[model samples]
Structures are given as structure tokens and as C-alpha cells.
Target: TKPKSRSLCMANPSAYNYTTDIFTAAALRWLETGRTASKPFFLYLSYTVPHAGGWGSWPRAPEDGNPVPSDLQYAAELSWPEVERDHAASVSYLDARIGEILRELERLELSSNTV
Candidate 1:
């Protein structure tokens, strides 16, 4: 059945991580359920990393602070070059998490037949 609305279960309206987390959670849930154990599944994991604008604000503090600004706040205050490094770091973190999920699939012996 088609979704009646864009919002699916617990959706966060304030950050991109929320979207990425939702997709990752769904994928993990499907992998956990061995019910459709034999069927080939196509997982379209769309992540929202590295995309600026919409929802989060990036600038409310100085750019040269010790701890640095929060991810959302940093993105808002600085220019592209300044924010790019932090954005790249955030993407790297997401990639690592996704890699871990893939490793889990391989461990379950569901990578081949379940793909």
C-alpha cells in the first residue's frame, strides 16, 4: 500500500541525520526479519548527508570557537569552503555506519541470495 502521507512513523523535521537514520533503521529491520528470507530484495538506501539548507540553522556563534559550532549551526554560518570539511567528515561517519550494516548482512549469509 502506498503511504498516505510523506511522514513515515517517527520523522524528524529538523535535521538530515533524521532522514538517514530512518532509512538505515528500515534496512536493518528488513535484514533482521528472516521471513522473506529467500526473496531477493532491492534496498534503495537514500541518504541525506552533505546536503545543505532546509530545516537546520548553522550560524549563531563565532566561527573560530574551540569546540567549533554544531554541525547544523556551522553549516549555516560559514562559507562553502569552511563548511565543506565538516560536511565531508559527517559524510565519512555516515559511510562508516553503512559499511557496518553491510558487514552485518554478510555475516548473516544473506548477502548473496537475499540481494
Candidate 2:
């Protein structure tokens, strides 16, 4: 058998959007206008974060290539190792995106019914 590829989920190749933003936007779109008004919907939204180690561009050092939008906020944590800071930033970025989805659910008055 052939060995599997190392890249599980590569980052977005575009400069303007990160992978998280793309997935989050899709979830938000569904919550906002893509769902059927007569039926309940199930959204299986997944995110890639703290694991930006997936293959992509070299905007920063090889260890810092995750491309998370919140990376800059963690850049100030000088006491921690660079890789750790990058991981934290990725997680924080994911958290904010999830918050957006949750807020959208609330806005649509579906939070009480959603799991």
C-alpha cells in the first residue's frame, strides 16, 4: 500500500481568507438564509485550528506557518515559545469564529432548539 499524504487539511491558498473563516462563513450562511423554514437543520461544522501545521505558504517561519488571523495577538506573549504562541492564537481565532456562529443562531432564534 502507498503511504498517506501528510496534509490532512491544507490552509486556504487565498491571501484574504483563512480556512476557519471559510468554514465559519458557510455555517453562518446556513444559519442566516440557507436553511429550510419548515424543517429543523443539523449543521456539522468543523474547524482547523491550533494545528495550522498543515502544509501551505511560508508567510512566516516554518514553525509559524499556521496563518491564523489572531496570531498577531499572541505575538506579544514573549515568555512563551514561538510555536506555543502560534498554537494559542490559532485556538483563539477558532473561538471567535465559533462565537460568530453561535450569535447567528441566537439572532435567528434557533439557539433554544439547536443542540
What TM-scores do the predictions have?
0.53, 0.60
List, residue by residue over 24-53, the lDDT tens digit for candidate 1.
777788778772547777777777675744
Candidate 2 local lDDT, 64-87, one digit each (tens): 455444455664433445555577
Off by over 4 Å in 1: 1-17, 35-37, 53-80
Q: Compared to the true structure, candidate 1 yields what TM-score?
A: 0.53
CA shift of 103, model 2, Å: 0.5
In model 2, residue pairs whose N, Cα or C atoms come closer than 3 Å (at least 3 residues apart or on different chains), thus clashing, are: none
lDDT of 1 at 31: 76
